[model samples]
Structure formats: C-alpha cells, structure tokens
Target: MSNDLIQVLQNLGRPQVLVLGDLILDRYIWGDAERVSQEAPVILLQADRSETRLGGAANVAQLLRGLEAGVSLAGVTGDDLDGRELRSELEALDVNCDAVLVDDTRPTTVKERFIGRAQHRHPHQMLRVDREQRTALDAQRSETLLQTVLPLIEKHQVVLISDYAKGVCTPEIVQQIITHARQVGVPVIVDPRPGEDYSLYHGATAVTPNRLETTRATGINVQSSDDAFAAGRQLCEELDLKNAFVTLDSDGIAVVQANGDAELLPTRRREVYDITGAGDMVLATIGVAMADGVSLADTARLANIAGGLEVEQIGVVPITRDQMLGDLLTGPRKTYQKVCDLDELAQHVSARRQLKQKIVLTNGCFDLLHVGHVHYLQQAADEGDCLIVAVNSDASIRRLDKAPDRPLFPQQERATMLAALDAVDYVLVFDEETPHALLDRLRPDLLVKGGTYRRDEIVGWELVESYGGDVKPLSVIPGVSTTQIVERLRGQTILKRPAVSQAHAPERKAG
Candidate 1:
C-alpha cells in the first residue's frame, strides 16, 4: 500500500462529485482608495473594475473543477440575471447543473464586496452587501431538492453539502440526501453552518467546521489543537460522524475520527491575501480525496495545503491542479497566482492588454530541473511583461519520438517546478505533440523557443509571425540537458559492472 500522494493523485481520476447547497454569486468591486470622503469618514473610492465569480456551493463546484475533478452542482436560484449567469458559468465548465431548480419566491443570492486597492498595501474589503431570501425552503421546494439530489447521489462517487443557511439546504433536503448516500455507500461530506444544530447533519461520513464554528456548535472554546481535537471528537460523536475536522485559521486543521483517534496537521505558511473561499477549497479537496478512497489523515493534509493556497490570493480564487502539485512537491509557489487554463488565459491577457502589458508564450518539455531550464525561462521572460510557459505532458513526450523513459519528471511536477520560478507568470500543460491549440487560443505578443531548432522549423512560428507576434529563439546552456544526464548515468552503470568474456559467459563453477 503506497501512500505516495502523486500516485493517489494519478489514480484519483475524474470522479463525479455532486455538490449540493446554497448557490451564490460573489461580486467584487475593485478600485483605488484615493482620499477621504467629505460627506463621511469613509474613504473615497474610484471604482474602475468589477467581476463576478461563483460563490457558496457554486464556489465549491468551481474549486473542484480547478482541481480537475468532474463536478455537478445542485441548488435553488431565482429566475433572475444572477441565476442565469451562474448557470451559464457552470454549464460552460461542463458541470451538470440539470438538478438546479429555478424558484419563484426568492432572488438569487448575490454577495457584493467593494474592495479598495492601494499603491503599496494589499487590497482591502471596504464593504459587503448581500441580496437574498433567507426564508426556509417551502415544503414543495424541499421535495423538489430531495428528488433532484437522491437520484444523483448514487450516480456520483461522493457527495458534498455546502450549507450557508440559505433556504435551499433545509433539514428535509439534507436528511434525504444523507440517507440515500448512506444506502448507496457513497460518502457524504458536509460543511455545516455555525451555531446551528448538527442533528440535521447526523450520519455524515465527515463534517468540516471551522474553529469559531466548533466553538459555537459544541460550546468548545478552541484556542489550541488540543481544544480543536476535543471539539471535533465531540461533534463527531454527537452527530454520529465517521470523522470530523475543525479548520483552525492559521494554526492548521485538527481532525478526529469516531474511533477516538485524532491528529492536528499544520498548514503550509503563505501570505494570507483574502480568505473568501478557503473553506470551500478545503471541502472540495476532501471530497476529491475521499472519493478516491484516500485515508482521512492524508485527506486532511491535502485539504490543509489547498486552504493555504486559497488564502494566498486576493479573491475567491480556485486552487489549480498545478498549484496543489507545486505545494506538494516544492512547498508554496506564489507564481500560481497567475496560472490558469486557456479560456482564463485569454481573459487574463485581454485584461493585461487593457493595462498595456505585453504577453509572451513559450512551450517545452522542462523535465529534470537544472540551471539551463531556469536561464531559458528567464530569457523567455525578458521578451514581454508576462510570460506563459506551456509544459509538454509525459505522453506528449512519448509521441515526440523520444525514448520510452523520457520525461524524468511527471507533467504536474514539471509545471509546478516552472511555476516556482520568478520569471514564470503562468504555467499550463499542453498534452499534444505541439502547442498549436494553446497558440491558437493565446495569440501571444511574443513566441519564444530554444535556439537548437531553426527559426523556420519552430512549431507555431508561422502563425505567430503572421499575427505580428515576434518569435524569439533563446540560446540554451551548453552541454546540459535531461537527456545528457540520463545518458551519463546509464554509461556509468554499464562501466561499473565486472568484466565478462566478450564471446560468451563462462560456465558457472559447481558449488
């Protein structure tokens, strides 16, 4: 039984994860806090930009998607603009929103935050306002949610409930989903509401409540890991949960199992930018790991890493596959703050273009980190304001006529290593033999490659040149490469062997 996280990550295929709870639309209004307002003591803000992202259960679904998991989100939303936008975004990601209901009584929940960005300091939340109907779900709506969730529970590998006390996650709905999931043997994980009765969430496989939440729910004043462990064990016992974890903000995650076993896993230190959806990140990570049959202790560790990465960003940012892999392999990699998929890359570059910044792109099989790779990346970074490196997947290396044992490092590790470098603003994996698909999507301001290949022979050079994008070929460091290192090792192994007769092996002496 190997406990290797990379092997687990490899085996944790795209399991269908069903996320049910309150769906919310989070809007961020970003601007500069230029001066003090005359009318009041509030700061004067020149709002320049605003954006909306999935929130609550929707945020969980998005986070699962970022971790490269198959997700389906179920909840209630009004037939309003925010509802429509939320559904459209989920559908665009191929998330199954079929079970989501359009209700008439409530407006779609929208949490709007006005944030102020200063020149030297980090962005701060100026104000937040929410619009929603907080009334309990009507019996008819409860029945609708139960019917929608029951059939899908068995279809998915695991079920996650993200309850924010919104009308959608009533007791009836939660119980029905839990009962059905128990019947089907699919584990149910719940992110419960603070100060509420955990009785409704009984029989869950696991419950993740934060420090303050544990204090409120169980009356446990948690100041240390020991207190958190006590709270977790008590909550698990009262609710009949198989496992319970209390998220201690900076200290770490303390988890307790029903068997009376407990452990506190400290989180990786990172810059706490904004903790908007950190719990969502933890819940989603647990859902993914649990569905793959990982141990609870390992699951908590991975969730801790995910939450740490979550707080390193300014908004409700999703922790990407590479970012987590980077955290697992090379500690914390801050450059992941800019890494994203092609669609997001397009949006990111367009915004950067609005800010009049140049975009540079380069693709390679950066296996086995060395000085050469770093310098090459640095040279590519010099070509533009933002550098995007596309890493070739291991399978892609095989298709490139390389040796069967090529790519000394896995694709995720390679991307993670690249993301740790200061020169790299973003890293994406391209599985094809060439990066033409990524090129077609990005159409970057500059295309860069190693000088080993002819200028005309470079892949995507013609397209880049045609679009007025410059193609740069940087000189690689001499006599240093992954192939050279591998070959040298192979030769050393052969030379170290005892000499044998060239014609044939001598007969063994009888003992």
Candidate 2:
C-alpha cells in the first residue's frame, strides 16, 4: 500500500455519515426452549431476559458510531414511548438525531423476536411480530423530512439510505435525498427493502441487498457465484448505480462495479450465533471505510469481517474498534508467494515435513512488525500443530515493491522477527517472489493472511486447493500501520530536531 493510503486509513475517525430512511426498534426476548404449552402446540419459552436496541436505519447509525464515525440520522418516528427510547439510544451513541421527525399519525416500527434456546442444539426463532405501516409518507410530512435533511446533506461525506419499506422512505424522499447528495458530491448508499422497486433507489452510489431482496428485485434466481454476479451486474445497470452488492448468507458477497468487474468475496467460515442486524453492520462498515478513503476492495473486506464478528454475538450488537483490533491481532498473517525456482524451495519444505509434525506454512514479508501481524500469526497457529513463515529476500522485495529503498527491514531481520513471535513455529527466507513451490513441498493444512486479500488473489491458491488445504485472511486493524508510525516520527524529527540541538549546545559547553 502507498504511504498516503496508509496515512488515510490510520487517521480514520468520525467522518460525517448521514443516515436517512426507515427508523425502527429491534426488541429481543431471550429464553430457553422447553416442552410445548398445554394451551397450544408451540414450544414453551422459559423467559430469561429481554432487551431493546436501535433497528433499521437506527441500527445502521449505531454501526457507524461503533466504527468511530460521526453519524447523523434523518427519518420519521412515532410520538410514542418507543420513539423516545429510540431517541435515547441514539443519544447514548452520540449520534445526531435532530432530523428524526416525530409524527403522531403512526406508531414507531418495532420487531419483537422471540428466541428459544436449548443445550447442545441450535437456537431457533419461534416468532417475530412486526409493527409498521407500508403506506407512503404524506406530502406535508415528506416535505418536512426533506426540509430537515437537505441542509445537512452537504455536511456529510457519505449518505446512507436504510429503508425497511416503512412510510419514512417514500419514493419522493429517496429521490430527493439522492439528488441532493449528488449535487453536493456525497456518495449515497442504500440498504433497500425486499419487493420494493429498484427504481426508488435510482442514481444511488451503491445498494446492498441480501440474497432474497436481490432475487425479488431483479427477478433473478441466484444459485451460484456466476448467477449472483450476473444478477448484481444486471441490477446495477438497470438502476444506473455506480456499484451494487448482493450478500448471500454463508456464500459471501458478490460486488458489481461500474467498470464491469464482478468480484466475489467468499464467506469466512464461522459458527453463527445470531444474524440480527448483520446486514446493517456490513453496510455501516463499508460506507464508513469508503468515506475514510479506503478502496472499494478494502471496504468490502472490512464489511465481511464486521459481519462475521456480528454473527458471533447475540442480538443486535455493534462491532467495536477494540474487538476488531483484537480479532486482527489474534490471527495468522497471510502471504503472497511467486515461485521462480520451485524445485529449490520444495526440497527444503519436503525435508521439514518428514519430521512427522503438523506443518503450518505461511508466507509474508515482515517489513514492519505491528499488532495486526502478531494477531494473524497467533490465529494461524490455532489451525495447525506448528507454523512456518516464509519471508521474501531483498531481491524479491524489490520485485514486489518496485522501489529502490523498500523493505524497511532486510530479509534476515524480518525472518528473525517472525521467529520471535510465539505464534510462529519456524521462519524461512526465500529469494524468489512466489511461494507456490514452497507450499507444494510443505503441503500445509492451512494458509492464512490478513483479511484484505481476496481468495482468488492469493498466490499458490491452486497448490493449496490441490492439497485439500484452506486459505484464510485475517481482519486488518483500522488505525494501525508501520508506515503511519514512520511518517509521524519523520515529521516530528523535522519539526523538533533543530530546536533541540540549539538548546542542548549551551548545556554541552557548560558541562
């Protein structure tokens, strides 16, 4: 990555993200599932605890806050108890809720989900009751919402429209928001409702639709990756959107960009606990990352990791920066290896494998040791009995970096650093660019990297595939990087060195 990009990512903080659309409350009733009740055929839920959280557009705002983004929400809510609670929640998150209009004509939208759990079995959702209005917002109310939101639109870097098909996201409101956002040069993203016409989201920068929503809106049955790519592309073209992504549960996400590239981000293998607000987490992370100047590919990777983290916890929970940092630190660092002399590295790999121990092979250059690299190696160790990190030599670094003064640390120093990490079992230095030859010989059970690279982008992927081994990417820390630290140190030195020297000269003479 370029120094400028790294600097931008490290300083990602509180970029204004405007959220306008359907506002709702997500209430969860948790308990154990026992025998059926005498009065009905339904299983009895031994009530344990219940909680209420911001849902719909409100949940999106919470996600933005969790990612350390400054958020402002614009929508309509009922003038009732639920609306008050929703407002309080937004306030607690430090989100600007002044644009959330209160109307007495309808009740606040609430989805009450009753979950039943049992030991050694999967928790099942027994019932979900929703309170909402499907009708369009009144002309006066729509105008009122526009009046409140239009002025604030120019203040944000990115605008998100989270519609749940509630009256708040009328056709007129969506069109107005899109138009104003375009005029002001703010990127607008949408999490659209199912069965709703895509025309409502015309001119949006991007729209994230789940599998069912995509199928319903595009009239395309997505069964495979190709089908998903085709559907996503068709939808983007039809809607005139700059980008479109369809999130397939357990199958990862498919993205179609304006440049006509269909990219598939495979799902990270995980045991899901709860899927509540997973989509919200994805949308918020991607939107915030993009606003913070991360590339589209990086944004997608962050979203995938955020979604994976959300499903590990119960209820409508937000993934915090600390949690993301921890996750990135606890996994194995992934490497890209290009092989020039496969036979040479293969010989060394075979000799090591003959010892009868589980060989964990990971390849990457340890140019700058950071917390993210440490966590990735630790996570990779958990996948196998031992870990091996192959470092690229100085020549190979020049090939990959395309810079005369790159590889901040030499190969020997880099290998020694990797060896010092407790998660790493062994460290080897390779002169060539790719590690395919080495991987073929090592035949490791797992190949790991930081979560930024797509599966298809991994070098030696074919070798791992042939050997029945899996390749995984760990999450990247949001605001941590070696380049940023170096730049800061350099800037500080330039600012303070002359003053320090001048001040110390008199003291030295006195001594």
TM-score of each: 0.66, 0.67
Question: Pick by lDDT: which candidate is best?
Answer: 1
* Model 2, span 1-511: residue lDDT tens: 2222223334566689999988889888988898888999878899888989889999999988988899999998899999999999899999999899998899999999998888625677789999987687899989998999999989999999898888888888899889988998999999998884789899999999999888888888888888888888888888888888788878888888977898887756777988988999999987898787776766776677788889987777889755654444333434322222345434434433443345566776666788867877788788776677777777787776433666778877777777766677567777767887667666887777653566655677778988798877656665444444444655744343334334222212111
Model 2 local distance difference test score: 0.76
Over 4 Å off, model 1? 1-3, 332-511
Lowest summed lDDT window (length 10), candidate 1: 502-511
